[model samples]
Target: MQLGLLYSGGKDSTLAALVLERFYDITLVTAHFGVTDEYEHARQAADAAGFEFRALELDREVAEEAVERMREDGYPRNGIQHVHEAALEAVADLDFDAIADGTRRDDRVPTVSRAQAQSLEDRHGVDYLSPLVGFGRNAVDRIVDAELDVEVGPSEEIPRADYEAELRAVLAEEHGEGAIREVFPDHDQTYVHGLRE
Candidate 1:
């Protein structure tokens, strides 16, 4: 089974690829927002992971539209949902049948919309296989630790929180802070606090 991995270069996503690669023809697909720093980090991860990598670029307009929709509807909101769809589309031209993600069963909870997982299976014939489904974050960390050669890269200088804050700030300026919180309520504060001046 040839599979396209929706990799973010994060440990979870990388571990997902490592697991699935055992059974499938895996190609790495990473989505970027066209920022130089983010793109470079992703590329480094891809290179280190040793998979042929493909890039999907989403610009500010796309991000804004999705964030706006997500704010109104909630998790698995239209915007975030579309990001996965766009990933599938980005790799549609490639030679793969299933697109896999790094979602663990632990991640399969009430908070994440079921529609997103169902949509992936229904629309793409792709199996949303969470190989680490039964494992929690700790287990993932342990597995990653066990595989010292996995080559997980260093933490980003600005970190994801910084990006989240930047996005939130932009959204607030464009719409309002209330709108951003409504859209991304669980925005990881580590990014926000770390990046704050």
Candidate 2:
């Protein structure tokens, strides 16, 4: 079956693609929230791993809307869910039987909710597979050692948290601190400060 692997140029997503490709005709689908280097790295990783890769630029309409809600309501709207909605929109038109991501058993399943997973499958009328669901970090290391040529280096400077924080930081730095607060006033102050630091 044809599958779409959600790639992020991280060890987990890359390794997930490695495993899934053994059983399916896999094409890597990557999304970038305006991080060009991160997007390019994922593309190169897809080439090295021998899967066709497509990069999707993340749309911020939902994110911006969520922040606006938080600003008015004094509560953080569901940011991750908003992200998933944006991702779903980006891939809504792709031709594929399934969508895959790099989630593992060790990673909190709740991090990506059942609703989110179901939405990918149910809304898109495709399977949502996580090949690494039962594998952990060691399994990933062994797979990388055995099958892939790319050296698994120190996790790129892009921490998972950096995904959202970088957007907020750039807005704060470029526009002004007040602009960020106006957009995401309820965002954890410590996170914004620490990311900038």
Candidate 3:
């Protein structure tokens, strides 16, 4: 089966692609609001993982809507979910047998709920899978450590394919740094430094 894997050029997504490669034809897909250097990074990561790579440009309006939703909700959980759903919806038009993401057991945001997953399969006829859903941080870390060479740092410090990165930049530029700080809040943002060895 051809699997469209939502990639972020991070350990989680890269590892997920590797795991699924055994059973499916993996195509790494990265979504961005506009032109970004992150796409190049994602391409390199996909090359390292030995998978085909594609970057999909998401509508800027979606990012705006997500920011607005975050402003209204007073948190980023809903906004992040909105972006994720938008990305998935954007990719749904492609001719892929199934869609997958790197959401782990511990992931709280950017994850499809059971209802949402069912809706995708039922309405869109696309199966949504999260290969790392059953794996915890420790197990995931061990696997990546053993199989991949990665550099980890705060989300801000690392350059990778992250939906929130563009959204945050736009929000900060249009609104202010305070807007980003308020919406995203203080959190641990970790990202993979580069392609796995």
Candidate 4:
């Protein structure tokens, strides 16, 4: 079956791709709001990972709304969660049998509840999969170490194609760079280089 995986060029997403590699024809897709060219980074990672790649355009209004919500909330969890749901819905609209993401069991945000997953599947007529949802950080890290090469650093330093990047750009453009720092705390981000040889 054909599957579209929401990819961010990060370890979790990349590892999710690897886990699903044998079961489906996977296309690594990056959802972007057209606010920046960061999607190109995901494209490169897809190439290195040897998967078909596509940049799916998301509604810019969603980004705008998410940024506004983040600004008001003074944190990114809700806004980021909103974008992630939108992204999953967007991916479900594609002509694939399944849609997947890298959200894990332990993640504090961006999680899809069982009801939400069922709703997505029921509405879209496609299975929604999250390959890493059952795995903890240690298990995921061990698999990533065995299967992929990654670059890890502070969030701003890492080149990535995820909601956070576009959100930061939008937040910065409208509010200011300081607003970005205010909304998003400093955390490590990862960029996958490729699978191990």
Each candidate structure's TM-score, on Cα atoms with residue i matched to residue i, is 0.64, 0.66, 0.91, 0.98
Q: What are the per-residue Cα lDDT tens digits for candidate 2 across 56-153?
A: 77655555554555456543335444565566556655888887777777764214567777876777788877778888768766765665554322
Ranked by TM-score, the better of candidates 2 and 3 is: 3
How many angstroms is residue 52 displaced in model 1 relative to the true structure, after the best TM-score fit? 1.3
* TM-score for candidate 2, residues paired by index: 0.66
Top candidate on TM-score is: 4
Q: Put down candidate 3 lDDT per residue, 1-197, tens digits, no spaces.
A: 99899998888998898789889998999999884566777887777667899999989899889888888987888888889998888777688999999999998887778898899878778988989999999999899888877867666777678787888887887789889878876545445544445
Q: List the candidate 2 regions with Cα displacement exceeding 4 Å.
A: 34-37, 62-85, 149-197
lDDT score at residue 184, model 1, on the 0-100 scale: 64
* Clashing pairs counted in every model: 3, 0, 1, 0
In model 3, the clashing pairs are: 155-189
* Candidates sorted on lDDT, descending: 4, 3, 2, 1
Residue 108 lDDT in model 2? 41
RMSD values for the candidates in order, in angstroms, are: 6.8, 7.8, 1.9, 0.7
Cα misplacement distance, residue 132 of candidate 4 (Å)? 0.6
